[model samples]
Target chain A: MVFRELSLPVRLLFYLFLIVAAVSILYPLTWMSYTSLKTNEEVMLSPFGLPTRVSFENIAEAWQTGNFTRLYANSLLIAIVSVVGIITISTTAAYGLARYHFNGNRALFLYFLVGMAVPTQALMVPSFKLMAILDSWAAALHLPVPLLNSPLAVILTYMSWSSLAIIFIRAYFMSIPPELEDAARVDGARELQILRHVMVPLAMPAIATMTIFYFVFFWNDFLWPLIYLHKHTLRTIPLGIMHFEGKYVSLWSLQVAALSLAAWPPIFIYVLFHRRIQRGLTEGALKF
Target chain B: MANTSQAGAAIPRMRPSRFRLPPGEAWRENLYGYLFISPWILGFVMFLAGPLLVSLGLMFTEYAGFKKITYVGLANFEELIKFDIRFIGSLRVSAVFAFWTVSLAIIISLAMALLLNQRFKGHTFFRGLFYLPAAVSGVAMTFVWAAMFEKDYGMFNQILRIFDFDRVAWLTSIEWALPSYIIMRLYGVGHYMVIMLAGLQSIPDDLHEAAKVDGANALALFRHVTLPLLSPTIFFLMIVGMIGSLQVFTEGFMLTQGGPARSTLFYVLYLYIVAFTERRFGYASVLAWLLFLIIMGLTLLQFWLARRWVHYESEEA
Candidate 1:
């Protein structure tokens, strides 16, 4: 692994390229942050200029008028519930595939893989119809709760898309040496006990990474939420941003402000989990 | 835990106690597997498979979503191919858009990955910063970019004005609308850069050292060694990128509404309009099938080409 040191010219070129790439990547976000604090008049008069008065008025207004409090709550509930559901079902299924020599296991695994390749566009129309049928069925059964346009609908849809998570977890589980599980079983541990006490804890890092990835995917999802949720109160962040833009067409400052608010949470989470996310993708699963 | 353990021992020891299931127990294990995956299976049969079949059937009919579907075999395809001028134009627009977007995204992201792979101060912070756009929703980013590209009182135009250039009509002008959307899409390089960085890191340092010892310069090393080794990852990213770009909708929907003169009328947006807005479900189905075919063909082509260029070290062994 010995290497020759780079010439001064090459080193300089490398740094120069890094600086340009860094600036280009960060410029739009920094500009958005700065523009969010400016007044409308200032925004129009000097769009790129430093704000004459830095104020929290736009942020306050966006929070209040954009209905983001409700949107945030809805998004959080959906993401959390879906993540829990995905982790539970996928972990069990992945463990079954990894540890058990059951009939049709290979066929079922291939089935799930095919599910990954099928585009959602092919399913959107039918899924909407199914939801309609379910809504009617709920009415006919005199169900106490409304099902359509609820966070529950979004959660169910999110669960349907958990095949990728299942595959990743299954791959991760396969990489774990069977000796650990054998050690547990030798102590007279049952299957569920071995899974709970041994395998789950050993796979915690991969699980944590999957949880974050699922959360980000669910939180940033727009198309499903837009299709299923028709009620104004049930709008998620992306749909809420669309509504805010339609209502406040002329005010770029407020739009930028609201947009920043909507985008910040997931970006912040990515910053905190960047290394884990990278490690999970490259070194954890899909390596072989 | 002790009480549960005692209760567990009190129960008769189940047959086939080992992890391996016996032939008789196989049915029960499979039942449990199906039960575990029941939600996804139910979802697939009811939601995904049903719609796909219905859409395929609908393509041969004239169903405006509200009315009873009347059979009109191949008419929708006929109209799209022969009569509709905008259909072909929109296809061209989408093809061009997908081509440039994927190519530019690959180049920029690879460059970024190369840069990020180098040891630098605040490397972690920069890596996170680069991934910011992907973590954020497309709709929110589109709104921000729309604001930035506003022809009047927009930051971009303002900058151009400062440089003594004409104020460009970013979204409204037919000539500039697609380019505006393309520029807006440049932020998406972050997603692919992370993937590419992962691939770059996986390349062993010994390979580079060997190249250096052979007096191979950076350019030569990259061309002969790095590029060949990186081809498989690049191939994966390109396929994903192409499939994704072909279905570009949110930006066109939110930012340009398929445009000043259908300049930004993307394929998926057109299909969406046909299905939802016009109630032309049959026509939309045909369009959807066409897209599927195109994607499948392209993917197969990529796989075939991969055999020629992709260097898998293990394969030689």
Candidate 2:
């Protein structure tokens, strides 16, 4: 028999392997989630055992002690604002680059694609210097505050370096039939009117997919925020959780609870939009 | 009624327009095109290009601070080659990590994708479950894994006890620490699985059937037909995976802290320390350039190898 007609024993083994793999992937995460629902005493007593009593108080205390509400607000603000900027900038640029054939169009598209290879860390030292320059520029212009230690600082960096988003969005725009734009133009719609009315609506799915990607990316980001924002109040969720973990080393239950709380938002989104996110991820990467 | 009707009337604007967009393709198309991408161009020039050039310059110099940047022609690179033991060791660690992680991730992902491609019960659920690790926050995931890899109370050790194996110090033992990271990386195979699945599904099913008709067994079919078609996808994953795994920071940073004996000190992590902790931006820039060259070399090498291995269907036709 051909290997295509697998015997029962082999197929059973395949199922077993898949089960083992799935369990290996999920058990630890579920264990951590379960650990969060238990008391500190319970966790100390039995690390592997299920909670004797479900405790809501652990999560509550974690929220209060970690200042997660404040951190959440900060993270939500940063993620939303940055994603907004990313969507706007990425969509416009993607639309323009994908549709309009200006001179050096291919070169400009190549420019963004090639930028993807330059590791973000390569720009660190210089980015620090550039931020300093911007800070002084802000100061000299008599701005309310220096630009370095603010959400805007991170937003500007994210917006400028959203190459992946641009690639995906541009692909989406390219996939769109230019016939729609032509039809709109024939009806007295200007270029702005065409983009705003037609292309934007057509490319919403890719745009939304990119929004989720960027939002989660910014939400989970540590390095930039770590280097830039020093103020305790300005700390994003990851920073706050890091600090919380450091300070409350023995509070494993509370830390786990905090982590679960922090983990939920992104996981929730990923679970909901697994298909779209996965598809978009592959489309961009597979373009090469 | 007349007064009300008169009140409803509003005046029209006198000005034709405040701003005219230069009245041509310069305004409409080319201008907007440049306008749209102006941010990226500016960012490329200021952030990417400037830093890249500055880093190149600083490779031969010592940039202590802005004003303290002294010209030290090739001293940084020479010192690194001659003296920096940690630098050499970190490179070794990064290479090993990248070599194992990328290959293993790709291989396992392909296996899982093949399994997932089968028509079976609850495969979708299993697929999503596998991808769960990638969805979780890096810091939080590390912490959970940190907890799981605990010597005394960790999940893996607990499983070892159940199987009558000795509870191994997964993260503490010098021998097991790197392996522990590899294990941690395995859980996220779901990501590459998704990509590979897409590629697998894109291959027409009739090709497999046709190969079978020609007396090609399943293994032979996969070898001659499926493998060649999948090569492009695998190559893509390897390039991305190599670049990413080389710069792995969040994992090693949180879990091992490049632990037991600088065993896990990644190249980027080392660069981070030199730049931030030690404030050796000049030396850091040298490391960055070295990193760039290494990645570029490997990527070019892969492209060269792809000429031998990767078979695009388009090229075949």
Candidate 3:
């Protein structure tokens, strides 16, 4: 619709720019995927050429050697737990702020807003110390695993960093009319029931947005995982890929395969819900 | 924009006023409210506010992880400013990276957003294709870029070789190392573009019709109409992008490790090295605080400057 207003030359220029942008982004990813199928000799000898014969050997080898199964398991575990934790925690808070006229509601909302600006790096050192203390507490309780090197550490960290999520869901909840709740109240539904039946279902779009965003964040996050997860078994995909890169420094095909392994899961998610992801990100960003 | 209202304003007219509630009813409502929000409050206190205070306290002390803590009155800051040339270098690297990346991302992403916003063929496909890289793991994307930036037989060098140009030492050279990272990082600007695209689509068509009826050209339409409308999104991207770039770690950490004379020693990377590798927790805390302060200052500055250029629709009478 907007393009119809532009002159022919300007329209042509815009198309040119779009095509270039698309190619610039796509070419690299294509190269990485195809190169993952090539042998090291093939990669070195014909840098621009396609693989002599398409093969999954490099991917299999990298997956086995890189312990990617464990990495995928770990990453998926963290992402699921973190997204669920963040969404539930934030949505509940947002519902409270949006629905209630209680004392300190605004103050608590502002507190979360302020937390959003505090960089994660600022809290790293103390977080490590706090986790150590928590680890000792867990040990005293005879828990099976330590929080420091386990997925639980990152999950707990992820749950706490949902200020944006709170603000977002609150904005979402406020847009929801009070009549729905009032009607539910008139029907003798409890507050929690009203929330579960009315509010949550109404806010599924926003929740899904938060879920996708937080899932992507947890999956791709490098810094916290690097700091918290020291054990090889606990490594997530990004950390695992970095470790794989270090160990197989000279194996080009294996490295590409490993990188591809790390990239594919999130890419698959994006492809499936590209429209929702795009719309949600923009809406969420504007809210922020 | 609708959600920017305060708590009282956000409350619906159907709800009874706070003063009208009976004591028992008010108490019950408060109980329910607190019960609902307890999760976030708990999280904030446990994971954020508590650690923040601890970090602030640690900033004023000298202690390794295993050693007894001792008071150090701004000694870490003193050393950072008065000595520690590498600290200065890291700040410079971070500043340059932030400056270039934030500006370049704004320009490129906005342009792409505008282009994708047009009713063209394959626009949705293009939008997703562009934004696809932003969805990939940063470590993985960095590896692909690292391969492409390899000195010999890399994709970039092969193209250059075909064109009879000399192979550029993309990652190894001190000058190129930072820019290469910037280039690699720009691949993920698709998120910002999508945000901008949404901003563009939200712009009312009648407003453009009015502008065009007044004999405005394309440049004038963009300058007088589109830019002011999009300024809020631009301002947002600027602040968030700057904050992100200033605290950049993964690219430098994964690829360079702050090598080639620490040319790409991002501020966070250096702080990580200091705290984790060198066991200078106290000094690293100081570095972290300074970065926090710097980011806070820059963010405030952007807000101040945004008052001049960031036009919100709500401001219209």
Candidate 4:
């Protein structure tokens, strides 16, 4: 066969390459899940073997022992609240940047874009110190709940760090046809009305994409949560599992099960909505 | 800032604005624009700008564990250069890790992207499988990798036994720890691959078809057509990948603690220990500044080099 056409052997080679790639990707994940189900004796005997039985016992034990039920509630609230906050903030900002032609708009767009580069490590100390000060200030002011170990700290941190979503959704808004907006304008639709009725529907794909990205990011994030979340009750899944593993390092099955439990939510979300996720990731990567 | 605001005020009055709404309508539009973007600006001022300024101020002072602060005036940086052996060691480790992992990850990502860009059965499933690692919990990924690299009774060593090879301490030994982590880090390549796939899709098929009709082989086609076309994407990934790998922290934080004779110590991990563990906020600010400077220098250097090689669609005929 010629260069443009694939021959049998070459096609088979491509298939083989894909199989190898897939295995490399899926192996460690399956390894974790399988190891979680295996007994300690079985694990020591054969680390790579499939579990002899498919049991819910490990899942149940990890949930109860790790206090994942409460952690899950806390993590879910933080993630959901953070995503909503990010979307609302970013959508407004992105809509302005993408649709409006005001003065210094480009400069403003670039300003928000700087969020992608401001390393969290650099902000770690200052944010911790700021939140502590805020907590005390709130306490002195007789505020209901202080900001230090509260979910507001995590949510605010995430919202400020959401310039990536702004960039993403802006690109999406930029892609929509200008004629659609013009048509709505001709019909005497106000700006807010056009945004709500016309533009929002057109931008749903992009919004859905950002929704998935922000959800996963907020859910899976470790460093910020570790720094800000001090209370045992406020601990997220990763934090709880981390401390649990430290205490029970010798309990292989429980530790593995906890890790599996910690990894599941995002993985489940990713699998269910991979098409949108892939689209979002690709566009973000391409645009950047 | 004042000048820019004045200029912003001046621009609309002399507008080439063909579809001019009334003055009141125009004023309202500007107000709405400002209102819409207000949240980000407010957040940036409160969270980012304020903290950034505080961090810069912290770099000059000596503050330990939220106690009394004393101004030190660049002494932290001076100590980093003159007396901090662990800091320098971690820098070396991070540089090495970034070099090997970023380049290898880029290549692996490109290769997978090329493979996935082809039309095949189960393409979406394969792509999804490859992209799996990006969504995984960082702590969970670290723990699983820690298990996989266990010295004894690990999956890898069990495989090595088949080839009559002795087991190696993947994460525990100095020689193997960095490289083992590099392998684990390769799992992140799928993310970059998806980016590459996006870039590849943007390249028109006719270019490849023309190259093929010109009697170009697959290798030649990739070299002349695909490589040049994908250069910008490659350059983008290079900058992002380098910046990311340079700030590597999670592995050492969650798994290694920069052990095995400090072979696994990363720049941020060491900084984290200073700030959070030792509670030296001022010194950690110094570390943050150094990391920022190193990243800035490298990013500038990449941009300079990119002028020599990166191809842009707009630059050509």
Measured by DockQ, the strongest candidate is 3
Residue B199 of model 2, lDDT score: 89
TM-scores computed on chain B for all candidates: 0.86, 0.83, 0.88, 0.86
lDDT of 3 at B311: 50
List model 1 lDDT by residue over A1-288, tens digit each: 111266778777866766787787677777788889998888888777779788888888999999889999998999999999878777877777765545667777766555555567655555666677687798999985555787887787777776777777777787677767666656778677877899889888878889999998888778789778999999999889999999987777898899889888877887788888777765532242
| Fnat for every candidate | 0.35, 0.40, 0.68, 0.53
Preferred candidate (TM-score higher): 1 or 2: 2
lDDT score for residue B262 of model 1: 90
lDDT of 3 by residue, B1-317 (tens): 22312233222222423343444455656877899999888988999889888888887788788748999988987898799998989999999999999999999998888777778888888888988988884889888898889888678888889999998999899989999989887888997899889888889999999999999998999999999998888888988899989888988898889988899999999999999999778888888888878787766666566566545432221
DockQ per model, Cα: 0.38, 0.34, 0.59, 0.50
- Candidate 1 global CA lDDT score: 0.75
- Model with the higher DockQ, candidate 1 or 3: 3
RMSD of each: 5.0, 7.8, 3.9, 4.5
TM-score of chain A of each: 0.93, 0.94, 0.94, 0.91
Highest TM-score against the true fold, candidate: 3
Q: What is the per-residue lDDT of model 3 for residues A196-251, given as tens digits with 9 covering 90 to 100? A: 99999999988988898889888899999988999999999999998889988888
| Local accuracy of candidate 1 as per-residue lDDT tens digits, B136-188 | 65677777787778777777898899999999998999999998877877777
Interface root-mean-square deviation, each candidate: 4.8, 7.2, 3.1, 4.0
Which one wins by DockQ: 2 or 3?
3
Docking level for model 1: acceptable
Better of 2 and 3 by TM-score: 3
Off by over 4 Å in 3: A1-17, A39-41, A143-145, B1-20, B298-317
Candidates 1 and 4: which is better by DockQ? 4
